[model samples]
Target: MANIYKILQELPNLSFEEIFLLQEKVTKEADFRSKELLKDVENTILACPQCGSKDFIKWCKYKETQRFKCKDCNSTFLPTTGSSVHWLKKPKLFLRFCVSMFSGNVCSLKTQSKEFGISPSTAFEWRHKALIALGQESPIFQGVTEMDDIWFRYSQKGRKGLKYSRKRGRSSHKGDNDFVSKVLMSKERGGELDISLIKIGRLDKSSIEQRLSGKFADTSVLVSDKHPSILSFAKSENLKHETFKSEQHGKKDIHVQTVNNLAASFKADVNHVLRGVSTKYLQNYANWFGVKEKYKGLKDKVKTIIKDCFSNNKAWDMFMNTELLYKDFILKKSKRTYRCPTVRYRKHQNWNFENAKRGTYI
Candidate 1:
């Protein structure tokens, strides 16, 4: 305190440019002092994120916050720059959000918006962003892996034509001409789980192979239901495959019960906790489910989430590239069935002069 007071006492006698220079020097010294104070407390070493150099010096301060300059790149940056939350405002709120998600607190976007005093859009974006980070961090599936496909209804919530369909509850059976979304899931018993929501039209052998290629080790035994796609995938990959009719009991070393149970739990979570997620963002929700299941048993899950939030820069890039456009969210004609007859629909179309001007008819 006396040294700071002496420095303050000498500052008033300096000119404007000299005062600026002195301020920079004081900031550097303060950074050194802070490093000295924290040397024994924090052992985590921080290197230059850009150049990967440790040869950096304190450059400036912003309201008592010290910034560093990389000697190799001659670039200045805050510690949070290049991190997942680099562009995030209200970081404390985001931390709290992470804790809530990690602790399995079932909070909706509306609830989060109210609690955090942010808009629902912001809450939705933040949730997906965190899910992206956690999804990228999901461990690889290995050992006795159980793989299966689960289905969710193609939903277009908060959009027109929702009233035409049944509100809430599962979609009609798969063969009923109802739109269904497919999710491929793999679980290593007592290990990691992977869930991938397929955006492509159907869940065929090719789609499964494309999405899950290189996911499992050749030596890892895969247990699955007798679905033809799964069987074909297992055969094509040359993996040791075991299959059972989904309803049949396991004979000895063959069953997809692990992934089956995981699928059931994941569906229940989406149905009850999330109150149904939109089909467009369903992949992100599935990712979140995988991450939640992955980290559920860890004692330091919160710490792990926070650490990943800072370190997973690629996750941020993934989140940025994930499109939330209306076109992507809307159900396609291939996934939907027209209720009315085509002739009758065309006859009843509201064609007008405006439609002619637009060179189209409804």
Candidate 2:
């Protein structure tokens, strides 16, 4: 406080040009800071982030913030220990980055990178960190859950080490399961949403169960197009099921139109706006989509997303772990057999296209 006052007192001694520059700097700082998480987040963080215990106490100050020792977990942690900003080098950039990330407007990584003066990789990483953190708050589907499957052409947009030309162009045409990535989108009537990337090359009962088994409430009614996988999932979960043919959506009250629209918009953002993303980061983008939908029409969308980035501790672990496991998944199980760049498949593949369908010939 004293330092701020002292600095202010010196402003009168500066030339008009210097004063103008100073004002510009201050305004920019204020703009970014307004979007930053407030220090009062400490009050809301009454429990230990690790063990969810309320008995933690401030043990010390580190990096200008309070660090506490959890009584139950016997672990030391900062308020943001489990959050996206936990390991961030530049905390000031969080909310500013989120404005571009969670906004209704589309921002490509390159554009964000240029705008924010960050590398494209840093932009990508930061975007996913915020997304994966927010994904921790999965909605519990209660009543009238609309469900549907949306597919993206298989992509390994950022993968390396290919010796042959990658697959490119329109795929998923005429049921090309071998080159498509499957995603399951579900939304309850109350606006609770779940959009998950199931896998490459098929929407199956097992995949739907993996994303939605425990998400639906006991009394929740499942609605969808008559995809056998959806029916099988509803049966397996013992959920009250209602479905219609894709063409018969509006004829009766039964429809999955809510989630269907969500899927289309999400696909536009992922495939068109961002010009397509890598298969590995598809789930992160899905979570990002959830962030937008969850807070749509709400004020302080950036503020809410910033708090979310600080709230979820487990998401950081999962995001990093998934990166570690990506090698094996892309190599052995990605179903990107033909032009895959992960391992030598006895197939020569020259890879290109930042937006390829597994980077194959379209």
Candidate 3:
């Protein structure tokens, strides 16, 4: 078996080839480790923000910046500076855990915390920041577009109290309700569904007109699931609009079933990992899944996925600081403990700082 101790030690300094060989050297090492090692390699190339210089002193490590100082500028920076983990308590493991969760390996907050040797709250914070960063990275869909909405319900058994009981199981926010109305927007040819959630009140004609303007040319075709609201807007814009019967939702060449299946799988996976996440933050989690699901089925598996995510150096830099990204919190009112904040917002909720600190974002 490979000596994980030796691999972990060398992992900080090893190149991708060396890391791969070390993992390969240990016959029983999980293939996942090799991917993690590669991610570590890519993580090291943080150029100097001041000078854009990759010439850094690799030996001088700071607690904040995992890498050494930039010799050219005499400045120090973390590998993910300007990225989401810059202010992180545990930068190295934070990135690793993120890759782990995205790869469907370490799937839960509890599991990730234990594996990475972090407090549950710390793990939760890392996960959340990673998610916010990932969502920010999703490409803006700008071709022929389709739009629709679906309703997802959340149980309120353990929520605040009987006072808001009526509103409990229903959506917790306006955006979420709008998500129901604008769920599946794009059903393109050859089985691709481009989905986006619009804010509440943004579902009307003026909203669509504003959002869709310049998104497509005057002559582009739009498809939907025959929602009257969607059709009405299509007619108003004088754009080509086609509606499919419910049975024909994913029929052959005209089907968006593949994307729907993907979305369903994503929802189930997230719901399972979060285990009763408040409805308010559902869309943020949904957005997280969208970014992850985009780069599907690479030939090299996990390694390629990690590389691609970290390759956008500038984007990565901007998202490294946790404090700069997420500013809200979710609190379990009954327990008086802070829950992790969701992308959505809720009013009059209470929180436990200790528990709030431990939410997974990505």
RMSD of 3: 10.1
Better of 1 and 2 by TM-score: 2
Candidate 1: residue 40 Cα off by (Å): 16
Worst 10 residues of 3 by lDDT: 328-337
- Considering TM-score, which of the candidate structures 2 and 3 is the better prediction for this target? 2
- Tens digit of per-residue lDDT, candidate 3, span 1-362: 16858757767897878877766767455545644554574465756654667787665555433455778988766555545544455655655676677777326667877888888867766665555444332223434555555445533323343454444333556553322423334444333344443333234555455445445455456766666767787887677766788877766444445556665675576456555454444544665566555555654555554444444334433233222222331121111233333332324222323322222221
> In model 3, which regions exceed 4 Å deviation?
1-79, 136-146, 154-194, 200-202, 206-212, 217-220, 232-238, 247-256, 270-273, 300-362
Candidate 1 vs. true structure, TM-score:
0.67
Instruction: State TM-scores per candidate.
Output: 0.67, 0.78, 0.56
Indicate which candidate wins on lDDT. 2
- The prediction achieving the highest TM-score against the true structure is 2
CA error at residue 26 for candidate 2, angstroms: 6.0
Q: Count the backbone clashes (under 3 Å) in each candidate.
A: 0, 15, 33
